[model samples]
Target chain A: MARTLRSALLLAPSAVLIGIFLIGLVRLIASSVLFDGQIDLHHYVDIMNRPDYIAMLGRTLRTAALTTFFCLLLGYPTAYYVARYQGNRNILLLLIIFPWLVSIVVRSYGWVVILGPRGLVNGFLMWTGMADRPLKLMYNDFGVVMGLVHVLLPFMIIAILSVLMQISRNLEEASMSLGGHPFYSFRTVLLPLSLPGILTGVTLVYLMSTGAIVTPLLLGGLGDTMIGTEIFQEVMHFFDYPKAAALATVLLVTAMAVVLPLQFLERWLSKRLTDGAPS
Target chain B: MIQTPHIPIASIVETQNLARDNTPAEPILSIDHVTKRFDGATAVSSVCIDIMQGEFVTLLGPSGCGKSTLLRMIAGFETPTHGRILMRGEDMSHRPAYDREIGLVFQNLALFPHMNVFDNVAFGLRARGRTDGLKAKVQDMLALVGLDGFDDRRTGQISGGQRQRVALARSLVTQPDVLLLDEPLSALDLKLRRQLQTELKRIQQETGITFVFVTHDQEEALSMSDRIAVMNAGRVEQFGSAVDTYHRPATEFVARFVGETNLLRGQVQAASGGRVTLKLDNVNATVTVPAGDSSLGLGTDVAISIRPEHMTLGTGTDQPIAATVLSHSFSGATITYALDSAAGRLLAQVPFQPGGGHPLPAKASVSVGWADTAVTLIPGKPGHSQSDMEN
Candidate 1:
């Protein structure tokens, strides 16, 4: 009985903080969806009817999917190489995670100078005569995906690398002894076991890319506005909290629909891959 | 004769021999003047051995003597730096392990954890490109190893002994020419090891395949092998049947290693065919030796080997050996008495009578005797034998 009290006491501070934050969020959401002494569905219906909102949502989903796909494709080779090499794993991980220490806003601003019309990329292209004029590279979908991939690829590689490292090298040798070459060994053994790790990375990249705000605000132009950037504008620019909160709720539900089932799939795959292990 | 294509067992054996001598009747596998050096330091030096087909040879030695390395070389897991490895008279010093068709059961067994027993057995068959009848063959091999109906069970779910049988089935299912077992039973307890030893011998008899087993335990090697190759310092000190190795050891190392032995340092007074007469500091004895090195002349230094069981306690003095009883131990059926003699402390095992052994009163006058045939001439200084076969 006393231990239970002590355990509850240890959890008191965190529980209190979470409770207060959740209450405030709920009130905020409630106010945005309800107004004038009557529950109104007008804001949500307007968001669905608007062409701009629909275009932004479509753009956000497509860009996030493409970004996550590229991250997995490029990250698998890097992770495999790191796991196979004998030395300097700590140094390599430190280098890859260094960007995470800097704030996302600061990272967005740094990319601004790189992908802007007169930035280093354009300057290099002009100096090398690769282009006759400054390229319209900034404020585009390409710029948005480039920045998001650079920020999120470490999660994919590190996740997959850790899983691959734990797999026994003996499995591969067994395959070879049983008449498999290196390529088929990777295909039959290493790839299947690593699927969970890859899926985990996929969900992370997709989730962060879907709801990403600051990168789009700084790097993407007016023509490339995503649903997350639109929601940010609705809350900050317009004092109409009801429409803004309604839009935020819609975005949250949309993101959850995509992320929840994929996360479930990742967990299911993880269990299947590890089930064959000798407990 | 070609109507049905049936051949008798004798003709099959004869046909195999007729094709075998295409290049010459070289050993099925030969370790020729092999020296293994690791990072410029010698691990095994100037060692050579030959294994014939269907021979149960054991690479027996203490730890770090390069017996494992020699076995690994035979498995093609290691390469000999300065010698040739000939398989069926062809040079295979640098062949990859997988191409050798030699199954190696690692000290850890190295069974695939992700595979069940049946799939594990089928691993080598699939690798060898056999598609059909693999399931039947796997079941047959499992039955041979007494693991039938364990097909779907995971390798992790079985007992240690059963896992050993599964590993055996897996390796044998490949039909490897030579099966290299590196202390396969060392992982089991004593009772299990004894049980598996008989099972392994039975399997060898049934399969008629060459089994080159590596072990540090002398008793395991001696009890299981048809021929034991006692090794030290990466070289074979002696190779012969267990009885020949124990009763007629060729080297001092072999004498000390194979069983309990009382080594008595002496100088050779006379040397002849299969016999050497030696004079020690306090006693003179004639010893018979296996025919190998007869180079030692009169006055050359040598040692006499007397096994503990060979020494008999008696009161009569017809050229009797004398020693003081230091301590004695009761071993149920037999009593092992430790005696301090001119050479050193020696152990003598005497059958315990119905009541008790004749307790030669402590520090009392006691005489010991052994026929000349019981003494073996070794080529080193005296060393005590504290080994026991009780357990």
Candidate 2:
């Protein structure tokens, strides 16, 4: 019918855009994975076999794990506090999410001043006589994780808070009325229901940590040389586009292999939990 | 945290004796001088009421009458600003809702959506450290509420009526001493509400728990309650058996609230022992009333109340009042005849079967009268009792 044609015409642009992007992505992936325009597994084998590649992969995963854990550790309490605020909770939420509106580079610089060896943390500790020598606080794995957590915690808190808001106060009241202490209610009811948010936060931190170039390049220790820095080196310093492209392609495949399934699992769990709610 | 007030032995002895008897007067919970205020507006003001064991008492009121606030206070969701609630003999005021052994079914029926029927029913038991016996208790409660085999089914898979039962069993499985239902049947269809009212009464009887229900529907309150506390504007106007509150209402508000009424405004012509004669537009009538309220004197106006069913079309030799039939509705059980009289419009219910349709057509002149005992004088113009008014 002409109506169907009109509707299809209305949807055509978005569909065309998606098709174009998909085709470009597919061609890029295929070209990188093939060697000299021939199908091969050399890139994947190189990714696994090279000591530098393996070390960078492990470091990337470790930093991502560390970032995720710290973000959640700090975020849970902040989200809970925000949720429990009886009035002006929206204003508080805006303040919490305000850092996200700021440039991540700027937030990273704020940490640069706060965590530098001769900066706030070192000065405070040394002045207090807690340390004889200034602690090497910046340009390390710890500093990198601290920066990533700062960048990623808002996402965790906002995600958790939105989900937390969906849970009824009545459930807590019902739990208490049935003789649960507040702590017990939090542990049993709140923590279980918040798993989806936690999963989202972990996945986000892990994916971002694996590809983090700027933060590691600026603040991390030389030992924390992740795959992202290598990608940068291959493209800009070495100008070996073939190997760089191949490495980037392998990294992309590896991340999808891990993150996609994890994301799917999180979605599946979320669906199962909310599956049978009566309207 | 636990501050129990000193009980006068007289009240205790009265309840103790009732506890021994088959009567429902045995005390389960007593709310004394409870009040709640929000900023400037008072929601509940110094309300005192005793809930007897195994009794079904309804706080029948209009919206914003503080009935729900009072129920919430009893449920431990609202802390009373001024007074104490005692469960049996111990203070329940400061205790959390769960610790008070009270089961409150919310107006929304707040069934845990993620849970199946079995898990929902078992939730309370698990919370109370009775998880060891949870399975048996859940099975027993589901069966008690007529949802035994439906336990494994999710809440979304059930009917509205079935969900309500699941909520009931969820609250009831904890073996609470008091079951507080807030407009529990309001969400159901008309037929379902009627059916559930009977089921609720049966459930209450079977469990023998004190049932305190809050409802704006007069019919629900009257049919389900042994005692109805008619409230308005955060205060109780009358608390008594349904029959007494309906027939011998103490205020004009009560008469109008519980059923359809014909209220006639008249000036008192004379006063005598237990009686008064009033003149309305030129017709005179005599009414019997209680003596203590002496506000009405000769020449002072008062409202006389007579239910429609009590008055009939007759040119009786005893008492004669004339009217014309204005409108009529013919239901199978009774024909409601609205008569336009000098006093105002009056509603009369004529039984269709017993009378075999002695239908009075519209615009027909008719004489309506009742026995001298049937009418009562109401004090003041009904001035809106907030307690008994429906939202």
Candidate 3:
């Protein structure tokens, strides 16, 4: 009884905060179903049939997946190097997390300066005679992805590095002694052991990218608008609370549709990898 | 003498050829003045040794004595800073670990936690691209290690002893020419360690593979190794068979490291008649030095090492050093008595047959004597008043 009381006391503040938000959400959902005091499902039906909303959902998923892929591709080597570096490892880790010291909004805007049409990359290309004119570097999917990957790559690197550091160097030595080349040893031993960390990184990046608003807004143009933008406009610009609520519900459902199965697949694959297929 | 070296076409080819006819030659692995340094600190100094084929050679020492470094150098996990390592007469000093074709059971076992017993055992064979009879080979290895039914169990699900067997089976399944063990049984309990020691010996003989084991435990080295390399401070103090290492340790470090010993600091009193008598510093006694030791000379300060078991009760023809029993304990088979003489304290191990003639208790006076051949004299620094030494 004392333990229960203590737990309840410890949880009371967060529970109260969540309760307030949940009641507000319930009210929003009720309003989403009622059209001026009469029960209706018009907003949800309209969202389902709307081609623009469906396309937005597809584009968001694609952008998130691409961002996750690029982050993993770039982060793995950096993580491996940082983890294996014998000297000054703390300095390298600090450098990996240095970008986070600045505000996220400021960092996103900083990318605008580097990736604009008159940015450093375009200037270098033209000066080096690589291009006749400035390239379309910003206000596109590329700019949005580059910015988001910059924001999220550290999550992946740190996750993988923590796991990589824990992996015994002897395992790789044993593999090499058993006639495995370096690459083969990495694939069989290091990669499989680091799967849990990879899964954590992928899930975190995927979910964060799916719900991302700042980078896409600051760097993306009209066609690159994601669900967050539409929901934002519905609430702030149009004062359409019901539509915003319904759109948020749809986005939440879509994220669950993708993330839940991925989590399950990772769990199943890890079991087979570690448990030898239950043979 | 440096033996002639031979290079097999490939380990796989050799494995196939040896399947029909099996014969091994001298010094399968040789370390010629090998040295290793880490971050400017010498981990293993210039060391030279020859490991014969099918011999169980153990590098035994305390921690940081460079035994593990020496073993790693042999296993090709480390590159020697100086000298050369040759396997079957071919220079393997700079070869990558994979090309060395030597099996290693790591100190932590290093069994793949992600792999089951079968997969772990089959790893080397598959890495070598020999999968035709891999299943049967894995099963055979598991059976040899006495873990036949544990094929499907992951490494984490097994006991420490079982993990050790898996590691052994994994290494032995590949049938490498040499198997290097880095204290593979150090993690087990005393009973399990003893059991696995016998099992390891049996497996080594059955496979006829060169075994190089590393450990700090003296008894394990004494019991398991065909030849023991007693190491101290990055140097091999002595390398010989267990009996030679025990009976005739070359240095004071080996004498103290390999087993319990009573050290007597003395000086050479006479060197004639093919016998040298050392006048002990504190006690009124003289000890005849072992024959054929050219190091001892007249008036030379020396430290004499005698195993505790070599000291016997009762006065003999030689001078009996009177000692008082300080404490004694019976360990079922033997009784160890800690005695304090006029010089210093020393230990004596005696057989414990119930109701034997000897019944000396604590604080009782006794005289202990040992044969001249039982003592080994090593060079020592002078000016110590007490003759007896204990470590």
Candidate 4:
């Protein structure tokens, strides 16, 4: 009994914090129905009927999916190179993770300077005569995606690199000695062994991008209104707490629906990839 | 040293000239004065050996003695700093492992953990782009190693002995010109190791494949090899058959490293007519080295080596060395007595004789003696004093 008490004491802080959040969420859900001293489903029905709100939600999911796909495509080779690098490994790792030390808001604003209409890329293009005028680069969906990918890429790389380091170098050598080429050896042996890292990186990138607010606010235009921006405007500008609460609950459920299936797929794929024979 | 040519049973039918005549056949693989240097320290220094076709040769030595380095160089994993490796008269010193046409069974067995037994055995065949009859070839190789029904089992799910067979089958299915085994049986238990050693010898004989095995275990080298290259300090000390290596060790390090022996320090008192007499250091006895051996010179210091089994509990015409029994260990068939004598500590092995009651107790005074012809005279003076199979 004493040991159980000690364990509970060790877990008290996190449990208390989660309990407070749960209670606040329950109250918010109750208030969403208890609008104007009457219990009704007014806010939830309003959110579902609004085409603009539904479009915003769809745009947010699309942008997050695109960012995660690009991050995976770019981050996997980068992580593989960094993990296999022999010389000055600490420097290479520090270079990859250095952007995380800066605040995400600061990093997003930095992207704003680079992706503006008269930014460095546009200036270079105009000077090289590749474009006659400055291209509209910032205040768009493309700008938002670039900013999100920049902010979230370190997480993906670090996850994959950690798993790559655990794989034995001898496995590759054994494959080559058995008459396999370098590419064939990597595809057959190294790729399957690194599946766990790849799954973790993809899931983390997807969730973080979907819930992003600051990057879209700073780098996107009026036409690229995401669900996070709408929720922010509903609570702070419109003072519609019930509508914001209902939207927040819907966003959380939708994110779980996407992420949970992905987690199950990860477990299933890892099993199949590592399973050697039918028996 | 004169080497007896190895004759594989299948080779007699294929190579009619070799079977019908007495002329020597060319070596299948030759390490011509190969040397490997890591940074500045020499790992293998000017080591030369010729592996005959269809022969089983072992590079035997203690750790850090450069046996593994030599084997890796032959496998095309490490390029020699000097000299060259020739496979059937073609220089393969610069070839990559995949292009060298040699198979290697690593010390860890290195079976692909993500592959099943069938896939592991088929890896080489597939890599070489041989898809036709791959399944049948894998089955035959598995049966050859006595793992016929384990096709679907993962490498991690198999036993150690089964893994050994898988590794062997994986390498042998490709039919490389030579097979290099880097102490593949060292990780197994004694009984399992013995069982696999017999299997390895049988496989080599049945397939008529040239096998170059590297091991630090002297007994494994002795029993499994047609020729043993006894190595020390990055050089081949002696290379000969097992009987010659045991009974006629060429160096003091080989005599000490290969088996349990008692080394006595002495100086040559007289040398004449292909014979020499050595005056022992502290035993107050003179030993006569037999005729037909003229290596010793007058006043030259030497080590006289006598195996523990050669020494018996008896007195000779020469004064019997007085000794007190320090301890005795009873192995199943033999009783090995550790003795403290005037010359230093020595060991003697005697058969248990089944119902021999109990051994002589510790501290009991006794006499130890051996025939002069039984002692091998090593030229180099002993460097370290105490000796028990380690130099």
DockQ result, candidate 1 = 0.23
lDDT of 3 by residue, B1-391 (tens): 1121222224434443464255445468888888899999998878888887778999989999899998888888889999999987889999998887799999998888888889888888877776766677788778888998898897888889989999999998777878999999888899999999999999887777779999999999999999988887788778889998898877778788878998887888888876788888788888776645555668888788889888887644345588889998878888889999876889999888787766577888788877777877666553222211111
Model 2: pairs clashing at backbone N, Cα or C within 3 Å: A177-B98, B62-B389, B231-B387, B231-B388, B232-B386, B232-B387, B233-B386
Residue-wise C-alpha lDDT for candidate 1, range A156-240, written one tens digit per residue: 9988998889877656655554555566567656777687788778888888898888888888888779877877887788766
DockQ of each: 0.23, 0.36, 0.54, 0.32
Put the candidates in TM-score order, highest first. 3, 2, 4, 1
User: Cα RMSDs of all predictions?
Assistant: 6.2, 6.1, 5.4, 6.2
Give candidate 2's TM-score. 0.83
Distance from true location, Cα of A36 in model 2, Å: 2.3
Per-residue CA lDDT of candidate 4, range A189-278, in tens?
788788789888988998888888889999988877888877888899999888888888788778888989988988887677565422
Regarding DockQ, does 1 or 2 come out ahead?
A: 2
Off by over 4 Å in 2: A1-33, A38-53, A74-93, A117-137, A183-194, A246-250, A253-279, B1-26, B265-272, B276-302, B312-324, B351-358, B364-369, B380-391
> Compared with the true structure, what per-residue lDDT tens digits does model 2 show for residues A184-255?
667556766777777777777778877888788777888668778888988899987667777777677777
Question: DockQ score for model 3, please?
Answer: 0.54
> Model 4: per-residue lDDT, tens digit, B330-387?
8988889999987998999977886757798999888888776687777766763211
Scored by DockQ, the top model is 3
lDDT leaderboard ranking: 3, 4, 2, 1
Categorize the docking of model 1. Answer: acceptable
**Chain B vs. true chain B: TM-score for each candidate?**
0.88, 0.86, 0.88, 0.88
